[model samples]
Target: MTTIRTVTGHDSAGASTIISHGPLPGCEEFIHSPGFSAALVWRTPPQARIVDHPGDPAQAESVIPAPGGSSALLVTFPPDDLAGGADFDPLAAAEELCQRLPGLGERFEAEAPGFHRTDTIDYGVVLDGEITLELDDGRTSMLRQGDIVVQMGTRHAWRNRGNTPARLLFVLIGAQRPPRGD
Candidate 1:
């Protein structure tokens, strides 16, 4: 028979040391810009939904109740709500934001602008500047402001290819697995 030992930190580390934590708190980031802002919230439990947009550089958002888990919402502040502390929308409110400027894709860098492929499904809406898109399937498209592109499970990237620094209110929705304990 083989013998093994299981060590317990509470008894060994003494009173001053905190052995292990039961659970940890999740984190998120809020992006604020001159004309737009975004809030990102994560869940402690596993992810459940995947608004698949493969190869597209943009992310997605949702409010479905996660089974046996919780989710965070990242909202963008609206223009009118500025003084009164603008209201935020995960994406529903972010849809028509870039109606005035031209668009290319999700990410449009000033230097060396081209395709930056991704692993999951993605969605993009152009807010400003012109965009140039090239896909893995040799399909290409251009988006002006106020256009929405849904890319599900394919390789893709974006290029501003313009003189200005364009902004696309991005939302990334990914695959959500069940919690480890679940």
Candidate 2:
């Protein structure tokens, strides 16, 4: 599916104007993980300043926003059964994920698969279809279209157990993890 992203910014005259309108740059379906797609929509570094031409922040190096930063992403997941088929290539898939997602991709646990954690608070909204949110304790929450989830720097993973694909939008804000008590 083509995701048309429209960006707004202030013109030289200080009037709000549409900066760009089209499919997100670099957004593509994963060849190794057929049916899966992810797009980095936007990003803002710490203490972001408003500029007349901000350009496209989606091309930034890291997907994991730094402290006080934020990022927006759109992800589509195919059914669980669709992954790791006979033609599936794990190494290629991992390489592609790391290259596309940058820091965020490295956070995924190899031992536990989808399980991962980050120092950021995320607000996720189910855009279409159904999915299951699994936490570290193995507890899961079934979510459907329009459902929302506030993830607080927790270890979690998303599972699409349904027959169809599921789409989700997430906004993540960088956060500081408090010092652990000994």
Candidate 3:
């Protein structure tokens, strides 16, 4: 867990102060595979924009209602997780997430080849190790530390090719698809 410091305005002081500093509140950790895990860092509800304030301290506890919302998460993929070997269960992790997060279950399709698309613009940064991002078109890219990917509602999957666990920080923001027949 990462320590999150929250700063807010001090009454009658006209200065900002650290009101809270510690691990994220209400953070949920999910172990998908043997070495793969995901932690929900925070989430913002829809229907309005954030105001100029410290925001909700318990906001992290709110589960994402749907795809058209904002969320930040940390995902770790273990090596050989996507190799499709005898030990690897490809759908096990997805199924687990789908069961826990209703939004994920809504996007997942039974017939898809482990490839799913979401109505969100995802900004993913490789925090450690290396990972391969594969798209539905068979194109793939190897991302290392400091690499950033702008995933625009694309159908994709992640695989860790390195011996170490690959950690990625993703900030997904809600997006609306273009109207049909345009």
Candidate 4:
């Protein structure tokens, strides 16, 4: 479980206040298999904007917000040895996620050629254990504790080659692509 401390400012006094501080009510847990589990920490609305007064700024949902919104999530991937024979369905999972999160289905690939791409910039940090980021071009990068990765809308996948669960924190921000001709 992860704890999130949210701070806000008061409109009248302009003083910082700890609005809510604690673990999330519950995480959107996705059980890819018996051992692999992923959780969505929190999500913001498409039109989210900071306000002067304290109020609800982040709408609760486990999906990509509009093209300018963002979301944060925590994922724990089981070791490849354990997950090797696990029954996993990436397409089904992606379909379910797209149904819950608008615009996500468009980026999902049932047969993504071992990689999936989304039109969003992502910031991923290794929180515990280790994992590998594999690209469609056959290149891979190992990420360990405290390491960070900035993924720009590219085809990729996260793989846990180690013998332990790999935990990661990822923040995805929606972005716009330049016009086709530009």
Candidate 5:
């Protein structure tokens, strides 16, 4: 699936213009994980300043934005059964994930499959198919197309139980983790 992203900016004459209009450079379909794909749409550093031409901020070294920063991501999840098939090579899959997702790939727990936590507040919207949000304690919430979720900084996993693929858009805002007692 191709996701075209259009970026607007000011021209040399200080007039608004279309800076870019094409698929994101960071978009990729996971070869190891069949039916899975992701696109890093855009990113902004802390206290991002507006510029006539901000250039392409879609390429990222890490999915976790710096404090006061933000990132927009589009992800498609395959059915749970498609994961770790008989021909699935764990090492290859890990390498592919690391290469495609960078810092976000390393966040998944090795001991617990699909479970990971980040120091950010994520606003997620289900774009297609259905999905289930599984929390640390086995709690689950079903989400369908048009559904939205405000995910705090909590350990969670996404599960696609249905046969069809699930697509979601997430906007993550970097935040500082509070003290344990707080």
Candidate 6:
């Protein structure tokens, strides 16, 4: 299984009371693993969360945080072929992603080889190089730096045309919502 690592992000997160919300239902609070670990928790409502880190200024990214309710968390999954991947279907996962992340932008088709996602809202910012976006009408768009894209139900794909590897901050949200207060 191929392993995907995360780079150390912003530093100095003081002890503050930030609401812990997730894209999925029954998720409310969050806690730090230890030593203010970078582990982001998905807690049920009412109960708050505690954070702990290993004293290391750098921490691996756990989950993409979002607002509460349908726009609570940004679900991210490794490429289907990645090792120990979230094993989440891209398309089907989109519905849940939409409910989790709100005020989303547009989605485009990526031309990344080994692409596999069914029913998932795939949204992300292109990091480096260029990637192609496939549309439902069989149309395609070239996504470069500073361009944001979102995908749902429609068939799409990603292709990395740059020799140097490119990275992205991607999120999977739900489009269709379940019964109220679910």
> Relative to the true structure, how large is the alpha-carbon lDDT of every model?
0.38, 0.90, 0.68, 0.68, 0.88, 0.37
Q: How close is candidate 5 to the true structure, as a TM-score?
A: 0.95
Tell me which residue pairs clash in candidate 4. Answer: none
Model 2: worst 10 consecutive residues (lDDT sum): 23-32
Candidates sorted by TM-score, best first: 2, 5, 4, 3, 6, 1
Per residue, candidate 3 scores C-alpha lDDT tens digits across 1-182 of 45474545454455556555666543344444566566566667676553444565343433342446787777777787443456655578667766555465457655764567777899999999999998976899999999999998888888786788788989888788787685
Tell me each candidate's RMSD, in Å, in order. Answer: 18.6, 1.3, 4.0, 3.5, 1.2, 12.9
Q: Which stretches of candidate 5 lie over 4 Å from their true place?
A: none
- Kindly give the number of clashing pairs for every candidate: 19, 0, 0, 0, 0, 48
Tens-digit per-residue lDDT, 11-30, candidate 5: 89999999889877655768
Whole-model alpha-carbon lDDT for candidate 4:
0.68
lDDT of 2 by residue, 6-124 (tens): 98889889999999899886568888888888889999999988887778887688999998999999999999999779988777888888888999888888888788999999999
Write one digit per residue (lDDT tens) for candidate 1, span 1-182. 11122212333334333333332211112232233333223332344443222122123233222233333322222232241235544342223222211121233332432344332344567766656666766677877677877765345655445555344434344444444596
TM-score for each prediction? Answer: 0.35, 0.96, 0.72, 0.73, 0.95, 0.37
Per lDDT, the best of the predicted structures is 2
* Cα lDDT, model 2, residue 113: 77
Encode model 4's per-residue lDDT on 77-168: one tens digit a residue: 77867763556676665665555444444565556522677768899999899999998767899999999999988888778889888888
Pairs of residues clashing in candidate 5 = none
- Consecutive 10-residue window with the lowest summed lDDT within model 1: 23-32
Worst 10 residues of 4 by lDDT: 53-62
lDDT of the structure predicted as candidate 5: 0.88
